[model samples]
Target chain A: MRVLGIDPGLTRCGVGVVEGSIGRPLSLVDVGVVRTSTELHVAHRLRELEVGLEEWLDRTRPDAVAVERVFSRSAVSTVMGTAQASGVAMLVAARRGLPVALHTPSEVKAAVTGNGRADKAQVGAMVARLLRLDAVPKPADAADSLALAICHVWRGGASDRIAAALEKQVAARTRGVRP
Target chain B: MRVLGIDPGLTRCGVGVVEGSIGRPLSLVDVGVVRTSTELHVAHRLRELEVGLEEWLDRTRPDAVAVERVFSRSAVSTVMGTAQASGVAMLVAARRGLPVALHTPSEVKAAVTGNGRADKAQVGAMVARLLRLDAVPKPADAADSLALAICHVWRGGASDRIAAALEKQVAARTRGVRP
Candidate 1:
C-alpha cells in the first residue's frame, strides 16, 4: 500500500510518500516540506498550510496517511501549533476517504531503527539505510516524515488486522456465536 | 460589525454570531453547537468540525471571527483537541478574508463580568443580560461563545486600531520619517 506520512508543524510541515508492504522493498515516491511564514497572521498561516496540504494530497493520492501523534510533554505553544497542523492533515485525509494512522515518535523510531529511544541522528541514518539512499534526507523533518511512512508500512497493516479480528469477535459475541 | 465567536472543542464546538458594535445594543444572529461522536475516527471527527465551521461561516458571513485561545493547563488530550478545533475556525475565516481575533478565557470573563476570575455562571448571567435574552443560552459552551462575540464587539475595534498604529509607526521608522 502507498502511505503518505506527515510530520506536522505550523511553520514547517514535513511530508513523504512511500510505496511498499511487509516483506517487500519500499520505494520512495516523494519527500518535501510545506512551510508557512511566522510573519503572517495566524489565520493566514493556517490557510497556507491547508492549501499546501491539499496540493500534496491531490498530487500523491496515497492509500493511507500516517501522522505523528502530538504529545503534551512539549511546551504549550509548540504543542498547540503541532496539534493544529495535525488536525489539518487528518481533515484532508478524511475528506478524501483515506485511512489515517497516528504513530508516536517512539513507535516510529522503533519501527525504523529497532530502538524506541533512538535519537534524531540515529533515526535519520536508519531511514537512509532502509530506503537505500546515498544519504539521509536533508532537513530532519523530511527524514522524520519518511520514517513515519516506513513505520506505517511495516506495522499499520498488522494493527488493522488485529482491530478487525477484535471487531469480529465482538460481533460474534453479540450474536451468541463462537468462531 | 458582525462577529462570529467560536468556543473550540473536539466533541462539542460552540458557535455564536452577534451583530452591532460598542455603544450599540448587540443582537444575537445565531447560536448553536457542532457535535462529533467520540466513537468516530479522529480524522472523521475533524472533518465533521471542518464542515460545521464552514457552514457557519457561509451562513453568517461575519465581518470578523473570534476564537477562545486554548491554554496548556488543561489535560493534554483536551488541549490538543481544542487547539485543532481552533485551527479549523481560523482557517475558515482566513479563506474568506475575515479578520480573526483570539481572546483568552480571562479576557472574555473580564469583558462580560468585570472580573477576570469570574466563574461560568457569572459570565452566562452577564451574557444573558447584555444580549437581552429571555434566559442564558443553553449549554455553557454556547453561552461562553456568545460572551466571546460580545467581548470582541466591545474590545476588538480598539485593539485593531492599536495594531494598525503600531504597524504605521514601524513603517515610518523604517522610512526614516516622522508622523
Candidate 2:
C-alpha cells in the first residue's frame, strides 16, 4: 500500500509518500514541503495549504494518509497552527475516501528507530536506511513525515482495517444499500 | 455592514449574523449552531462543518466573518478542536472572498458589555439588549457568537479596511490587473 505522510505546520508542511506494507521493503515515492507565506492572512495561508495538499493527493493517489498528531504540550504559539494544518490534511484525505491515520511523534520515532525518544538525526538516519536513500531527507519535517508513513505502514494494521470498514459501512448506508 | 460570527467548536459550532454599522442599532439576522456528532471521525466532522458554514454563508451573504480567536491555554482536550474549527470557518469565508476577522473572547466581552472580563451572562444580556431581542440566544455558544458579531461591528474599523484593501490587491494581482 502507498501512504502519504504529512508533518503538518502552517508555514512549512512536510509531505512524503512511501510505497510499501508490513514485512516488505519500503520505497520512497516523493518528499517535499508545502510552504506558505507568513505575510499572508491565516485564512489565505490555509487556502494555499489546501491547494498544495490537493495537488499532492492528485499526483500521488496514495491509498492512505498519515499525519503527525499534534499535542497541546507544544509551544503555545505553534501548536494551534500545527493542529489546523493537520485538520486540513485529514479533511483532504477523507474527502477522497482515503483512510487517514494520526501518529504521535514518539510513535513514529519508535516505529522507525526502535527508540521512542530518538532524536531528529537518529530518525532521519533510520528513514534513509529503510528507504534505501543515500541521504536523509532535508528539512527535519520531510524526514519526520517519512517516519510517520513508515510507522503507519508498520502499525496501521488494525486501525486501517477499522477505518476502511467504517467507510464502507457509511457509504453503504448513504446509498440506501444497507439498513 | 453585516457580519457572521462563529464560536468555533468540534461538536457544536455557534453561528450568528448581525446587520448594522458601528454606531447604529444592530439587528439579528440569524442565530443557530452547526453540530456534528462526536461519533463521526474528526475529518468527517470538519467536512460537515464546512458544509454547514457554506450554507450559512449562502443564506446570509454577510459582508464579513467574525470568528473567536483560539488560544492554547484552554483545556488541552478541546483547544485543538477549537483551533481546527476556527481554521475551517476562516477558510470558508476567505474562499468566498469575504473579509474575516478574529475577535478574542475578552475583546468580544468588552465590545458588547463595556467590560473585558464580563461574564458570559453579562455579555449575553448586552447582546440581547443591543439587538433588541426579547431573550438571550439559547445555548451559550449562540450568545457568544452574537457577541462576537456585535464586537466586530463596533470595532472592526481599521482592521476591516486593511483586510479589504489587502484582498483587493491580491485579487488584482491574481488577475494580472496590476503593475
Candidate 3:
C-alpha cells in the first residue's frame, strides 16, 4: 500500500510517501516540507497549507494518510498551530476518501525504532536504513513524516489481517458453518 | 459594517452576524449553531465545519469576520477542536478577502459589559440589551457569538479609525501638505 505521512506544523509541514506491504521492502516515493511564511496572516498561512497539501494528495494519491497526533501539553506556544495544521492535513485526506491514521511521536519512534523513547538521530537513522536511503532526510520533520508513513503501513497490515479474519468468521456464520 | 462572529467548537459552533458601526445601534442579522455528530471522524467533522462556515459567509456576506481566540491552556480536552474550528473559520473569511478579527473571551465580556470578568449570564444579558433583542439568544454559544461580533464591531471601530487616519497622513505626505 502507498501511504502518505505528515508531520503537521504551521511554519513547516513535512510530507512523505512510502509504498510497501508486509513481508516486502519499503520504498520512498517522495518527501518534502511545506513551508509558510511568518509574515503572512495566520488565515493566509492556513490557506497556503491547504493548497500545498491538496497538491501533494493529487500527485501521490496514497491509499492511506498518516498524520502525527499533536498533543496540547507538549508546547504551549506551538500546540495550537500544530493542531490547526494537523486538522487541515486530515481534512484534505478525508476529502479524497483516503483512510487517515494518527500516530503519536512516541508511537512513530517505537514503530521505526525498537524503543519509543528513541532520539531524533536514532529515528532518522532507522528510517534511512529501512528505506535504503543514502542519508537521512533533512529537517527532522521530513524524516519524522517518513517514520509515520512506515509505521502506518506496518500497523495497518496487522489491522487489515484482523478485519479479514473477522469477515471470514461472519461469512461462515451466515452459512451455518461455524468452525 | 457587518461582521460575522464565531465561537468555535467541534460539537456546537456558534455563529452570529451583527450589522452596525460604533456609536450607532447594533442590529442582529442572524444567530445560530453549527453542530457535527460525535460519531463522525475528526476529519469529517472539520470538513462539515468548513462547509458550514462557507455557507454562512456566502449567505451573510459580512464585511468582516470575528472568531473567538482559542487559548491552548483553556480546557485541555477540547482546545484542539476549538483551534481547528477557529482555523477553518479564519480560512473561509480570508479566502474571500474579508478582514478577520480574533477576540478573547475576556475581551468579549469587557466589550459587551463593563467588566472583563462578567459571567455568561451577564454577557448574554448585555448582548441582548446592546442588540435590542427581545430575549437573549438560546444556548450560551449563540449568545457568546453575538457578544464576540459586538465586541469586534466596538473594538474594530477604533482600529479602523486609526487605519483611516494613517492613510490620510500618508496621502497628505505624498501631496507635500502638512497638517
Candidate 4:
C-alpha cells in the first residue's frame, strides 16, 4: 500500500510518500517540506499549511496517512504548534476518507533502524539503505518523514489486519454466528 | 463587531458568539458546545470538530474569531488535544478571511472578572452579568468561550489599531516620508 507520512511542524512540516507493503521492497514516490512564515498570524500560517498539505494530498494520493504523534514532553514553546500542525495533517487525511496512523518517534526508529534509541544519523542511514538511495534525504525532517512512512508500511499492515479480525469477530458475536 | 469565541477541546469544545464593540453592551448571539466521542479515532474526532466549527462559522458569519490560547503547562494529556482543536478553529476563520485573535486564560478572566487569577465561578458570574443573561451559562467551557469573545472585543481592537498604525508608519518610512 502506498503511504504518506507527515512530520508535522508549524514553520516546517515534512511530507513524504512511499509505495510498498510488509515484506516488499519500498519505492520512494515523493518527498518535500511545507513551510509557513513565522512572522504571519497563526491563523494565516495554519491556512498556508492546510493548503500545502491539500496540494500534496491531491498530487500524491496515498492509501494511508501516517503522522508522527506529538509528545507533550517536548519543548514547551513548540509543543502547541507541533500538535496544531499534526492536527491539520490528520484532518486532511480524514477528510479524504484515508486511514490515519500515528506512530511515536521511538516506534518509527525501531521499525526502520531496529533500535528504538537510534539517533538521527542512524535513522537517516537506515532509510537510505532501505530505499536503496545514493544518499540520505536532505533536511532531517524530510528523512524523518520517509522513515515514518517506511515504519507505517512495516507495522501498520499487521495492525490493520488485527483490527479487522477483531471487528469480524465482534460482528459474528452480534449475529450469533459460530466462529 | 460580531465575534465568535472558541474554547477548544477534543471531547467538548465550547463555542459562543457575541455582538458588540469595546464600549457597547455585549449581546449573546449564540452559545453552544460541540462534542466528539472519546471512543472514536483521533482523526475522526478532529474531523467532527472541523465540521462542527465550520457549521458555526457559516451560521454566525462573525467578523472575527477569538480562540483561547493553549498553554503547554496545562494537563499533560489534554493540552495536545486542546491545541489541535484550537488549530481547527483558527483554520476555519482564516479560510473565511475573518480576523482571529488568541486570548490567554488569564487575559479572558481579567477582561470578564477584573482579575487575571479569577476562578471559574467568578468568570462565569461575570459573563452572565456582562451579557445580561438570566443565569450563568451551563458548562464552564461555554462561559469561558463567551469571556474570550468579550476579552477580544475589549483588548484586541486596541492591539489591532496599534498594529495597523505600525504598518502605516513602516510604509511611510519606506517612502522617506516624515512622521
Q: Over 4 Å off in model 2, which ranges?
A: A168-179, B169-179
The number of the candidate with the highest DockQ is: 2
DockQ of every model listed? 0.30, 0.38, 0.21, 0.31
Give me the displacement of residue A152 in model 4, in angstroms: 0.5
Candidate 3 lDDT tens digits, A1-179:
99999999999999999999878999999999998767565766776787788778888989888899887776569888888899888767755556777888898999899899999999999999999999999999999999999999998765444433443433332233110
- Score candidate 3 by TM-score against the native: 0.88
Residue A59 in model 1: shift from native, Å? 1.5
What stretches of model 1 exceed 4 Å from their correct place? A158-179, B158-179
Interface RMSD of 1: 13.5
How close to the true structure is residue A22 of candidate 2, measured as C-alpha lDDT? 83
Candidate with better lDDT, 2 vs 3:
2
Q: Give the best candidate by TM-score.
A: 2
Per-residue lDDT for B1-179 in model 2, tens only?
Answer: 99999999989999999999966889999999999768777776777787778889988999999999999887668888888889889877876668888889999998888899999899989999999999999899999999999899888878888877766755543332110
Q: List candidate 3 stretches off by more than 4 Å.
A: A157-179, B157-179
Ranking of models by lDDT = 2, 4, 1, 3
Q: Residue-wise lDDT of candidate 4 within A65-106, one digit each (tens)?
A: 999999887766888889999998987776666778899999
> Which tens-of-lDDT digit does each residue in B1-179 have in candidate 1?
99899999989899999998879898999999999758666776777777778778878988888899987667655778888888888877766656778999999999989999999999999998988999999899999999999999998996555534443433332233110
